[model samples]
Target: MRPLTDQEMKVVLDKLANYMSDLKSLIAPLEDGDRYVFRLNHNRVYYVKLSLANLATCVGRDALLSLGTCLGKMTKSGKFRLHITALPILARGARHKIWVKENGAQPFLYGSNIVKAHVGRWSEDCPEHQGCVVYSMADIPLGFGVTARSTTEARRLDPTGIVCFRQADCGEYLRDEDTLFAG
Candidate 1:
């Protein structure tokens, strides 16, 4: 509701840094470009190992779309599990002020009220908070940046490369199709 002050920004940034480190560690065992599928409880979790360069590409492509791209980037194996890399992290980068606005990023820049490298999405409706979360170009570090905002305005805001979804009670996304979904 109110502007994010300098102190608030730092806290979120701290969270993002720890998150990225944990994420990097998680994927460290997997070879670069390798994808993994894990079944957590009855739900499925997909992961892919990727570098910063590949992450940049995803940001460029998914930045302008109205609905954040879904599991289009997931690599499929067997029948249930899908493999995906740090698309969510890339997505947070794409929206970072540091990445600079690429093609089709204007509209998204205007509406969002928040953007931070450490804020990750807990629900399907995440990102595109416009200048509210906009971080300085120098604030981003070379790792995964989590992005988030209130669920109420998610559909209306359009930060570039944001992911949008409505989750079911079972923790499974009803449907997802990001540009990166396995080809």
Candidate 2:
């Protein structure tokens, strides 16, 4: 394909530059021609998929952010049909867990023989509220959108992604792993 015209390129670059910080709106309407460059967990540069329309395009620096941040954003309500392509990590040997709290009336499901569900102070004590449908380690997989349960008493939310990396270089996600999330 012919290169983008000078004017076309400028317009594209400007959109990219403008959508720098927390550009949620821009991302929401991104089209086939739109582009983005975001970082993996360890600040590793990676191109994002831009199939907003029919023709595919490339997103170079100035789009993506750390994986931790991205997953956190998705945890919110009304997430769009997002597409992501990146290196997949090896599954953790231990159990996978995620902690969640509904923003409104508590969410529940009917089990074979249960009528009770978690109510007030939901997620306050994971062990408690046995009736509610809170997140569990066994149901989760290693990837984005997995919110980390607070490791501390504060119970604050930390959106984290499990990327495979050595001790010295964590969060550096790879495009394709000969080894893992990063080279």
Off-target runs (Cα >4 Å) in candidate 1 are 1-15, 18-22, 26-104, 107-148, 156-183
Alpha carbon lDDT at 122, candidate 2? 24
Give me candidate 1's TM-score against the actual structure: 0.19
Candidate 2, 55: how far from true, in Å?
A: 4.0
Q: 1-183 in candidate 1: lDDT tens per residue?
A: 112245433443343342233334433455555543221111222222234223433443334231212222111332222212333443342333223223212322333322322233333333343211222244422222233444555444555424321111111122233323322
Q: Give the best candidate by lDDT.
A: 1
lDDT of 2 by residue, 1-183 (tens): 123345544443333332122334334545665654332322232334343211322433343222321211111232211112221211122122233323211121111111122111323333321112223233322222211232232234223321111111112233223423222
> Stretches of candidate 2 above 4 Å error?
1-47, 50-54, 57-135, 141-183
Please list the C-alpha lDDT of all candidates, in the order they appear. 0.30, 0.26
TM-score for each candidate, following the candidate numbering:
0.19, 0.17
Candidate 2 worst ten-residue window by lDDT: 161-170
RMSD (Å) per prediction: 18.6, 16.8
